[model samples]
Target: MAAPTSEPGTFAVTYRWGLPLDEAAIAAVSELTCHLLKGCSPGSSCGCKVNRNLTRLVRQGVEMEMPDPTLIYSEGRTGLPMADMWLAMVNPYRLTSPSRVYSPDFRRPRVQQWP
Candidate 1:
């Protein structure tokens, strides 16, 4: 874990496992992003704020790798700070948003305990 956000369960982690980085692997990575975005306390003030473009790309039925070398993106509460760091490192010249995204304007997903 690089650094944890204000949320107790959220952290900025860099997973650099050595592999061929195939299309299947990229799909799995994208799915992991989805999981992290969906993993949040329901009805809590700290919820996930997902990127609609990413979701749309996922829904498009096309399999392609993300261009950025950062590999992972954290838009929700779990990885907001990390996301900022990512943007700064990747594109420091570009104007980026701040930490005003703590509360997602949408409802969060409810995860149930397994039997």
Candidate 2:
């Protein structure tokens, strides 16, 4: 099992494969993560924080083979039970999709490196 390493102010959610991904969802998360990571201003819409380590910006949802997961928080309005249901099942390769994928910028609190 992946141990929880959520920072005190960080929001987190799991992303599993074979799930439907919405463009709006992706945009919303990308903005949130980038803003929270201090990459961009609250007034500006910066894309998801780029994981300079991986040399790519983390998106709303990732592929199954993605080894590291980003931060994901549930939207207050949309009560998608998808995460709960997904957590119950047995899927080892599941990808954790937090509402916002943490910025991969080295200075941020949650940066990931591929093993």
Candidate 3:
């Protein structure tokens, strides 16, 4: 698959894996997520930072058919990452925003209260 065209420094370094993710994959992904979170701005929410980076990694992994352990971690935290990645990759220009959907700005009407 073609290398991601996004700007450099937007994502973390690529991780190489001998095979698809296993239990070890979980540990690796968590470690990488922590590392990525460390670099985010102090005011930035940890959950958001983790999710964004992980989502990018997973999307790349699925398309390439080689799951990077780091990206796999994102999937472990929230299964949606892998599925979201697949959808995003298929429709690169799609405007769908997970953040707005999952964690909406409270200023707006709280529609369909979440459990």
Candidate 4:
């Protein structure tokens, strides 16, 4: 697998295998990303944080196998249920907008003098 290249605030995670990723693998990647983000310091960019940890996981013995959903269920196995559900919930709300913009309005302050 190729190493991930990320900018200061942006990260790109790529799966190098020619095959599509399975749900379990996707879930694992998601978990890994979250773990990294949680450890990031305040004011650190999230993308960079996630990418760093993902690189570690990929380096580890985690297989990039893409398992079939049907096969997983056929054996009456609940395979990575929590991650799957969390992904389902988070996917829809993933990128509605860019980062929040805060505006500042500066005006002369009104002072009341004692009568």
Best by TM-score: 4
Q: Could you give me the TM-score of model 2 versus the true structure? A: 0.21
lDDT digits (tens) for residues 33-57 of candidate 3: 6656765768665444443423233
Ranking by lDDT: 4, 3, 1, 2
Q: In candidate 3, how many Å is residue 60 off? A: 48
Least lDDT summed over 10 consecutive residues: which range in candidate 1?
A: 69-78
Clashes of each: 0, 12, 0, 0
> Considering TM-score, where higher is better, how would the candidates rank from best to worst?
4, 1, 2, 3
Q: Give the clashing pairs for model 1.
A: none
- What digit string (tens of lDDT, one per residue) describes model 4 on residues 1-115? 3544654655676677767878766776777567567658677664433322121224366655545555654644334556556555556454545667555775657999999
Error of 3 at 3 (Å): 40
Show model 4 residue runs off by greater than 4 Å: 1-17, 43-115
Query: In model 2, how large is the Cα lDDT of residue 17?
Result: 84
- Model 2: per-residue lDDT, tens digit, 4-94? 5564655577788876757654555555454556645554444444442343455677533322323233322111234333333434345
TM per candidate comes to 0.22, 0.21, 0.20, 0.23
Worst 10 residues of 2 by lDDT: 71-80
Instruction: State the lDDT of candidate 1 residue by residue for 1-115, as single tens digits.
Output: 4445766777665787776765544555565566565656455343344333442235468765433322334322223444445545545665455435556777778999999
Candidate 4: the clashing residue pairs are none
Q: What does the lDDT read for residue 1 in candidate 1?
A: 48
- The list of candidate 1 runs beyond 4 A from truth reads 1-41, 47-79, 95-115
The clash tally of candidate 4 reads 0
